[model samples]
Target chain A: MNFLAIIGRVVLALLAEIGRLSLFIWQSVSHIFRPPFFWRLVAQQMMRIGYFSLPVVALTAFFTGGALALQIYYGGNEFNSESIVATIVALGITRELGPVLGGLMVAGRVSAAIAAELGTMRVTEQIDALTTLSTNPYKYLVVPRVVAAVLTLPLLVFVADIIGIMGGFVVGTTTLDFNAGVYIKNTVDFLKFDDVMSGLIKAGVFGFIIAIMGCFHGFHSKGGAQGVGRATTNAVVSASILILAANYVMTSLLFAN
Target chain B: MSDAKIELRNVHKRFGSKVVLDGINLTVPKGQSLVVIGGSGTGKSVMIKCVLGIIRPDRGEIFVDGKNVLKMDSGQREAVLRKFGMLFQGAALFDSLAVWENVAFGLIQGRRMKRKAAKDIAIEKLAKVGLGPEVGELYPAELSGGMQKRVGLARAIAADPEIIFFDEPTTGLDPITADVINELIVDRVKDLGATTLSITHDMSSVRKIADRVAMIYKGKIIWEGPRDRIDDSGNDYVDQFIHGRAEGPIGMDVLKP
Candidate 1:
């Protein structure tokens, strides 16, 4: 009975927190349409979230694709299905690994940075300082980040997909005893715009999740140094988890048709 | 022009079970500087945040230039915010942007000025804060703590606001640097003829920058008077706080821990 009561209390508290978060998200989204749009800040965020983030995402995708290609070929040859290696590698990377892994990687890097930076600002009363100056912290800080992520993650995913496919090709041709021409042809023939588009769409959603979690945790952080640290960890963990969950749901939806 | 620039009436703010601001009532006439002074966690920052609309009060109203801030629409709030400038405690400069870009953040992002023009004004503002044109090219991380504070001050004054808020403007600086920052603050406020509100535990800052001093304790302004009368405010909490006594009423409450 005591365990059940504790579980009930925890669930209720979580629900309440979720409800508040949803409200905050709604307000943030609504602020986009309202006046005093900070376009410059949005552009700056795009540079930070999208541009600066590229090297990491690209590097991760390249290695992921190369490893997938080699591993799939070895696994497939054992079953005498070596001819399908390129098709399988491309499909798997585009459909699953590209979006999901990319999202998680970006979450680990970007979300933690955002949370730590903003959390420190919160502890130092910088957000409050913005308000006193009559600047909307939401408009100045949150909106730019959210909008930038929503816009840029898809681009990042698109780039990541190309780099990942290239990685797979390098592994296939150089290490897996496959002809470069055949591997390229098979990859091109097997993948569809829909497959890539699905991944890109997932990227967009994952980006939003990463940014929202980062901003939310940072904005609500309390205490001092320890609070900022907790917020950073929470941001990364929640963003990664949400990205994975959302990827599953999105993939199911996209392929269900 | 001669009116109560900012007014907090019977404002109350509570963080869970702990009431942070309890029935705060105060008025600052236009172009005046009012500094709230108390020990750490005494609700000085909370009171200023409530007035700035950064933290909503559980009860009561805040008025800026006789306009009810809490009731303003998003557009209207942004408009009101345009009249305010703030120098945060830790100089929350955007790390990704150059020093000039950080100073011109509000002007460009909030106002959408062309980049060249923004850069020019940012340079000028940097100069006002004792930073040279060359300093504009450096990132915020490259600056020392004192330099960062100067950059923050430059950003606060960049928009040429009618009112300004300084949150612990001199808390982390060396005594000489703190004094320099205080003088810059006084000079800038005078130049703009801007009404000002600041929260600080630094008695030197209060003495140097404040026209009036209010001592807060247990989330309320226990005493307020002209700066000259602070030494004889006749309130035990105010006396203890101003004198930095560890054996007084304020210390006794904290001593329980």
Candidate 2:
């Protein structure tokens, strides 16, 4: 009976958390269309969420591409199909690796920062202060971030795709002794515009997930320093998990037909 | 109901099993300062937050200017919120913004005033709080606690709100700084002729600024009277609290052995 009670309690708590998150998301999104839009704030957030994140996203893409090319070279050795590395690298980077890896990296950087900043503000009553000043916290803080992330993530992922393909090309030619002209020709031949678009669509969704999770966790955080720390951890963890889960769901849907 | 500037009728709120506010009933008339005095975790902050619409009471009616705010839609509630300003315990200034910008946030963001006009008003308010224009350019992190409190005060009064809420305006400051804040608060309230509701554990602030005082105990307002009458309220809880005595009906949570 005690074990059953414990299980019941856990289920109830989980349901409550889900409900709270849904409400927070609904409020944040709905406020996006409401009047008194802060164009300046949105522009500022785009810089923070997109531009500042360039280097980390770039490095991650470049390294992942190099590693992927090496793995393909080793794996295809037995089949004498090592020549396929160029096409595979381009297709894989454009369709999956670029957006997923970029989203994850940015989630770690941007999600943690958003959670820490908002959690600190929450604990200190700055959110409440915004309310008292006749400013909707959602409109003033959350909307700009969510909008920026959604807009910026796709752009970041696109850049990551280009950088990732470049990394794979460098490894294929220099390390694997593949012909640079043949590799480039193979990549351009097999990679379709749809593959790139699919990844970008996924990037857009991942961006929303990252920002919303960060904002939700931080907005509801309580206690103080320990609480803010806990929120930051939760934001990064939740955003990363959601990104992967969402990517899988999106892949299934986009490829279903 | 009788045209009080702020009124809470039987407001009830609970967090899990802990009842933070239980039937909290209070009223503050226009152009008056009503300070609620209570020890930590006695629903003082919760009550004010209820009025500010930061926290929704589980069951009750809240009226600002005799309008049932709890029943209003988001748009209506926001309209009501325009008349309010608040100063938080930690000052709760936007750390990302400069001091003048923090002070001018409501004016520019909430009221949609142009940046140049808002800056002029922000500077004027800062001067009212004894902060020079040079101090306005610095960030909140650069200011001392007292200066931050002063900036917070300036921000609270920047738009000349009809109602103001101050939550622990003097906490975490030296006695002199606290007194200076209290003086500024008094001066600002008079200048605006605003209805002010303040909650603090500081007895000196209560004495200096409160036209009327209410004491909350165990999620209920246990005693209330004019400031001059607090010392002779004839209530033991009030006596214990005002005197800062530990041995009384109010026991600290950890001392329950």
Candidate 3:
């Protein structure tokens, strides 16, 4: 009975948090329409969440695409289906690898940064300062991040998709015996707008999850330095897990033939 | 109308098995500087957080300008928040943005002014905090501790709030810098004609900047009076804390192995 009660309490707590989160979202959306929009913060968040993140995302995509191309080339040759290398690389990167890898990379960098930044603010009481100034901390801190993440992740993924394909190209043409023209042509042919679009959509969802997890953990951080550390770790791990879980669900819905 | 800018009545806050704030009652008159002093873990920070709604009280009411903050809708709460500013313990500047941008964050994001105007105001605020426009071009990580604290102060005052919260604002600074900060706090607050509430264990800060001082012990305000009377507070807890004596009412618990 005690264990059941604990479980029930946990569920209730989760429901309460969901309710709070939804309310926060509603307030943020209303603020988006309200006068005195914070364009500077929006632009600042865009640069922080998107531009500074480019190097890590680019590095991950390049390596993953290269590795995937090599692996597929070797495996496909054994099955006498080596011509599928370009198609497989293109499809994989566009449909699964690009968005998932990009999201995960961003989750590692951006989530940790957000959590740390906000956690420090929490512990040091800058968040309290925001409130004392007659400003909403959620509106001031969470909204820009969430909005920027939602809007900019697609653009980041678009860049990631292109970089990843290039990575596969380098390996397929230079290391493998595939014709450069054919590889490029096959990759182009296999990729539809929907395939690319799906990845971008996933990116948007992943971005939202990352930002939420970061803000939630930071906003609720306890103790001091150690607590902030825990919040940052939780932000990264939870965001990565959520990104993967969300990718599976999204992919299934987008491609359930 | 009540002259009190903020009033807390019978406030209570608990975290699981521990009660962080117990029936906290305090008042700050308009344009007055009130400092809350206590030992570490005495809930000095928690009490201030409760007033700002960073942590909600389990029971009781908080009024800012005679408005019951606990009962306000998000819209109303945010409106109330706009009247406040804060300086955090560790100078919680956003590392990503240049110094000016951090100061102007509220003006641009919460107020939705143009970037040029915001940046201009940001620079001006930075100057008020004894920083030049060149310093505004740098990121928080590039700044020294004193600079960061000054920047934090700039950000806090950026919106020209009618109320300000200072959380351990001088704890981490060197004596000279701490004195400078204390003076700046007094100067800026006086300039705004703002009501101020600050939490700190630093006696020097309390003496230099506070019009009145309240000492919290074990989640309650044990003593409160004009700053001049703190030396003769006659309460053992307040005496022990302000004098930095480990004996008397405050026991020295083993902090770590």
| Top candidate (DockQ) | 2
All candidates: DockQ: 0.45, 0.85, 0.44
Q: Please list all clashing residue pairs in model 2, or write none if there are none.
A: none
Model 2 regions lying over 4 Å from their true place: A78-82, B1-3, B253-257
| TM-score, cand. 1 | 0.86
Which ranges of candidate 3 are over 4 A from the true structure?
Answer: A1-36, A40-83, A133-135, A159-193, A222-225, B95-160, B174-192, B227-234, B242-244, B252-257
What TM-score is obtained for chain B in each of the predicted models?
0.96, 0.97, 0.97
lDDT of model 2 at residue B134? 94
Q: How do the residues B1-257 of candidate 1 rate in per-residue lDDT, one tens digit apiece?
A: 34899888899889889988888898988888999887788788777767666777899988998989999986788788888887877787777679998888787767878899999999999998898999999999999999999999999899999888888999889999999999999998888999899999999999999999887777777788899998988888888787788887765554363
Question: Considering DockQ, where higher is better, how would the candidates rank from best to worst?
Answer: 2, 1, 3
Q: Which candidate, 2 or 3, has the higher DockQ?
A: 2
TM-score list, all predictions: 0.86, 0.97, 0.80
What DockQ class does candidate 1 belong to? Answer: acceptable
lDDT of 3 by residue, B173-224 (tens): 8999999999999999988899999998888888899999998888888889
What interface RMSD, in Å and to 1 decimal, does model 3 have? Answer: 2.7
Candidate 2's DockQ is 0.85
Model 2 residue B26 CA deviation in Å: 1.3
Model 1 is docked with a DockQ of 0.45
lDDT of 2 by residue, B1-113 (tens): 46588888999999889999999889998888999999888888889888888888899998889899999998899899889888988899999999999999998888889
